[model samples]
Target: MQRAITAIYRTRDVAHLVRDELERLGLARHHITVIHKDVRTADPNAADTSGTVDPADGIVPAVGTAGGAYVGAGMVPGAYMGAMPGYGLGMPAYSEADLVYADAFDALHDLHLPEEDTRTYQQAIRNGDYVVSVEVDEDADIARIQEVMRRPEDVHDLTELDKTYRDAVYAPRRRPPREGYRDGMMGRRADLQNSPTTRDYIREEPLWPKGGTA
Candidate 1:
């Protein structure tokens, strides 16, 4: 089985150049995946092309605008200040405004990356970074692939996302319902809250069935 290695870049143009370089270095184009945000349909003139942006910088103003608008709308009734159009700090990681526009490209190839790797790349792309993943079976090839794609300053290191990615990918698996557990309030109450990893809510008093006899 081939192992997947990924990298993130700042610009779509650079990502394309790296993809071409990877193809020339014996890595099959089909084995590479470039994951990025799609923004082709956006008005060409509407984009903010004023060089690089810090996600934190945009978040504050967007939040202030939303908060003020919400308050104004509540007071003035028909007057509505719509939500801020772009992403800024404090918003969820992958919200519409938080997305960074990527170069127009079709995902013709699939790297078949592991779930963990895919999650890692997904976060990077959502953070407005361009991501590239290449599969290689040989250990030596890993270094070569990275070397060709290396822009140390530009690469979004997967190591930094280890904690966040693992929590997102594995947390759901840890929370699967216990055997024979149902789905509604009945199940929630009956289910033994045993897992130490999650919150525990058990007591001698009956808190269900609308005031049941304890």
Candidate 2:
């Protein structure tokens, strides 16, 4: 069965690094996706539309409108216009940011994740955090991808976040600290290094695939 494993990162750079590492692990680039806020925009709520993956190469294209206008495809009309009044008179009705947010939300919803979890991730992206999702078939691949994502120094596991939210909302209970929490917030590299399949795959595949440089 195919399933998605998603996590949150503090920055776009770290999210990209995680994606690259996943690709190095023999996961297809198209199976991975990253959504984050557009730092170039002064508005914190604006999302980066360029983060959408191109179906041709599974890469985020460097495309954007010149004056903060949305001009590409997959736009959701009136997605945000209804929320803000007076947008029907002279405005473009929807900004590029609005379209991207709608796209991001739609992408996350397609994963079939829980409604609250999806909303939580959307809010995180709106708050400028990066969300990286990987689609996997085999259980081993799921484990491998999760290991790679969590190996990042400051990545947050979505499952853990969900658990924390549930615990806070339902019952406050004492929970043990996460593994490697005391080790300067660094993930355990030894775990991945110890995996025989991971070692062999890393040896077989070039870190950078042909046709592009990471």
Which candidate achieves the best lDDT against the true structure? 2
lDDT of 2 by residue, 82-172 (tens): 3234443443343445454544444443333444666567666665777776655434455667678775477765545656554232111
Off by over 4 Å in 2: 39-100, 157-214
Candidate 2's TM-score: 0.50
Count clashing pairs, candidate 1: 4
Clashes of each: 4, 0
Count clashing residue pairs in model 2.
0
The models' CA-based lDDT, in order, is 0.38, 0.46
Candidate 2 backbone collisions, by pair: none
Tens-digit per-residue lDDT, 49-91, candidate 1: 3332222211111111111111110122222222233323333
Candidate number of the best TM-score: 2
Instruction: State how far residue 143 of model 2 sits from its true place (Å).
Output: 2.3
